[model samples]
Target: MATPIQMPSLSPTMKEGKIVKWLKKVGDKVSSGEAVAEVETDKSNLEIEAFDDGYLLQIVVGEDQMAAVGAPIAFLGAKGEKVDAGKSAAKPAEAPSAAKPPPPPAPAAKPAAAPPPAAPAAGGGGGGRIAVAMPSLSPTMKEGKIVKWLKKVGDKVSSGDAIAELETDKSNLEIEAYDDGTLAEIVVGENQTAEVGAPIAYLTAKGGKAAAAAPAPAPAAPAPAAPAPSAPAQASGGGQVVPLRREEPAAAGGRRLRASPLAKKIARERGLDINQVRGSGPSGRIVKRDIEEALTKGVSAPAAKKAPAPGARPAAGVRPEPQVVPLTSMRKVIAQRMTEVKPGVPHFYLTIEVDMDAAVKVREEAKAMDLKVSVNDLIVKAVAMAVRRYPKINVSLQGDHVVQYSTVDVGIAVALEEGLITPILKDADQKGLQAISTEVRELAERARKRALKPDEYTGGSITVSNLGMYGIDQFVAVINPPQASILAVGAVADKAVVINGQLAVRKMMTATLSCDHRVIDGAIGAEFLRELRGLLEHPTRLLF
Candidate 1:
């Protein structure tokens, strides 16, 4: 019988994936657990492995083509198995958006070679003992740290009870139990990291085998006994049945705000302050609706000041022979991108000064309530709202075509040890200040830890880079490719200026907009900045 190799759903948000390259060609023998293709999902690149051993009989989706999740990408069958080339070459249909995952390939009619060894079940009992393994929580995660264990050794747990909090590259997520049982043993301790598909713990039915002190290490070429709990039995952190777990409020500069994981994720993505957003969920638990209502009310928060640059790189004069530093993978990619975007995209610049008196007043008022809003947050809201009016400025150049985005998603540039990453605030124009602040804090936290998901960092028509905290008066920022513009912000300082024909000292800030001439003209970019300046100059306008 022919075994179909379906496109695996790599991430929660991934609908389809592009085949970057095929490792196995037709007529080549393939083994179970062997990587056959490299796929690019919305989040990152990952290798897809074979589940059955056989000859690579057909390639259904060739290199560079995209196939929806569960769509057959290839077929594996016994060598010289008489596959009809015409039928096997037929194009695979796109799986329906809500399609259930395909069932695992049935056992081969006759064995091709020795089937891969089955991973040993933890607890090693014959009856219903189940082995639990580290699951692929998010699309881009390769490994995860066991932040904490929710259930201890020999603790009784019911199906759906959260067993642990796994910290992935993007965020922390909870792991739940599938069957009611007593946790037998902990293989990976708290604070320890494990690769995906590695056994982490075990569970056995009550009154079964006496629990072991520690889970035995996985055997060499052991049977793959622990598959991630099936969808019918498992749920994500934000899934329908919200599992109530005690989460400490996230801290920002010595202040903590209590919010649910879903609420935190939403707040961070929208750049909202979780502290200001009221909670409507049970016992004042903040959820998605509260964040939405806060935005509808048009409440805006202040922006964050940049953290001081680390005490000026210790004097290079102190017996330093030019230090050699190797570029990290992320830094190398950043370098490559800059090389492509800086020269290939023709860039134009526009600079403007804004009277920050009203914005400053707004920040002071927010501070009275202990809201840690920053000036940058206000500027992001203003720029996003302004971009909505000047659609050309919110666009990307695709070949000769200018693609104007419908939603106002803005990217905030965050500098990290391994290069810089811009985690996007999707639909920034529609969010309130509090929401933007929360999101910016979370995204910045994760980006610095090198844990942002692909979609979180990928799409944005414009980006904002603030250097006010570093006291940069003004500077031009290089454009990120495809996007039409990037806004560079400088520090706010008191300066002598004319207010109603009288000389007075007023708070002022400088901002420069770097534009891609292919997608935005000088007039278009200038008009956008004019609206932005007006919004910031009248901070109250952001309230409505």
Candidate 2:
């Protein structure tokens, strides 16, 4: 029997991965659990193994191209078996989110306008008791594990108070109460898993009877419905698809090919050699029509190009094709979080330029002392010290409250291929420059590998985003939520400046602080930057 080998989920949050290379070519595979192909996800490059022992019959997705999770990448079959890869492979489904305006961030339980009360859900009782079910804490969360219960039976629970903690698909978030009541009965125990909307606990009014609820296993299992329902939508959205179409070699008869982006993408995906395909566009540029015609009406494919000489540049007038890259899970989460946090929260940016000559000299001296201090490490140290002097800079703008953290945990933004992740240097103000340097490097390396645990990335009071290494003069960064401020650090380079009275060259850097106006007022943000500039300019102050 011929079976299709589907793309595997390589990382915890990977939606897709690029096919790096196939280790085994067609007719070469024979063992189960053997490595077949290498896949490169945003996190790391890993080899995907074959589960069944069979001959490698066909490659569905080619090298250097991306495939969504569960999309077929190859076909396997017995020796001399005919593998109908096209029939066995499932077509990539169209995304429904593209048609709908981005829904409110999945974390926000209710939309901006809370809807009117519904007829009674699973947990509603007669005596002012509403059932508190296992909540859907993250998008794509089906069932959740209850990490701990915050409120025990007989405890008074206030509306909007966190009653339990759940470990969801993304992160661990608390379950909040919807009505004021007493915790009457715990339906689901801690460490137990329950379906979303299934009763986890029951809350009742004072002297009110508890509601009897059953946490049934049956929710009709809607998981399989997603793959089935999207086929019609995918077929309806005709122009959007490229991978679903199969290709065949035609008789040699067509014009030279210089393909359009759409035509080029289609050709690349379908494994078509459109180099000599007939074109109807300007200057004989191959269009989608040309690709379709070539598949059906044959085209004369151009011979493979000769190898270029050593150190030679790429051919002139040969531009890479512009194609679509779907959003990864990390990117989608980032987009959702940013869209949710950026608006509605008032933001203010403050920029300051500082003399970096002294700090630069100190860094050189540290390097001589075998210290691994870099520009970001210095900024992290400075920001940490600044927050200590002005605690308002290390605060979170919670709803109707400002939380000023006692410890200065500075977050360093590490860029990934698909998105940005921050890993914290806890108690940064208390650590030495060398210690900060080492920790930042380790955190960043792990972050890039997506190996950092949830605790390592979360709970930072303030974040430092440095583009100085990239030679950026200055840029503002959006404040990470719950975080009151983000400091953007630019390059430390020589510039002509007036010191005392004479115009001389000095190392100078620009730093911008983006603040949530609710937590940090304009003056507070300025004062914090002033304190930061003093530390960096003096250099000696940061040594302690």
**Winning candidate number (TM-score):** 1
Tens-digit per-residue lDDT, 1-544, candidate 2: 6675666654445565555445676567557767677665544445677778888665555443455565555667877765333233332311321233443334122211111111111123335344666643323446888889998999998644668877654445567664567898998899998875566887775432222111111111111122333433322221111120011112212312234566777778877776545444322335666678767754333322212212232221121112223444663454456547766555789999999988888889889998878767878898899888887677664433345565677999988786787788877887899899998999888777655544466668799999998999899999877677899888888899998999999999999999876556789899999999999998789887
Q: Model 1 reaches what TM-score against the true structure?
A: 0.47
Compared with the true structure, the alpha-carbon lDDT of candidate 1 equals 0.63
For every candidate in turn, the CA RMSD to the true structure comes to: 17.0, 24.9
Clashing residue pairs in candidate 2 (N, C-alpha, C atoms within 3 angstroms) = 123-131
Lowest lDDT 10-mer window, candidate 2?
239-248
Query: Which sections of candidate 2 miss by over 4 Å?
Result: 1-343
What are the Cα lDDT values of the candidates?
0.63, 0.61
Q: List runs of model 1 lying over 4 Å from the truth.
A: 1-5, 8-141, 152-159, 169-171, 177-187, 196-350, 361-374, 392-406, 409-428, 431-463, 475-486, 496-506, 514-527, 538-544
| lDDT for each residue of candidate 1 in 44-112, tens digit (9 for 90 to 100) | 456677877898765555443455555555667887764553133221221121132442222211111
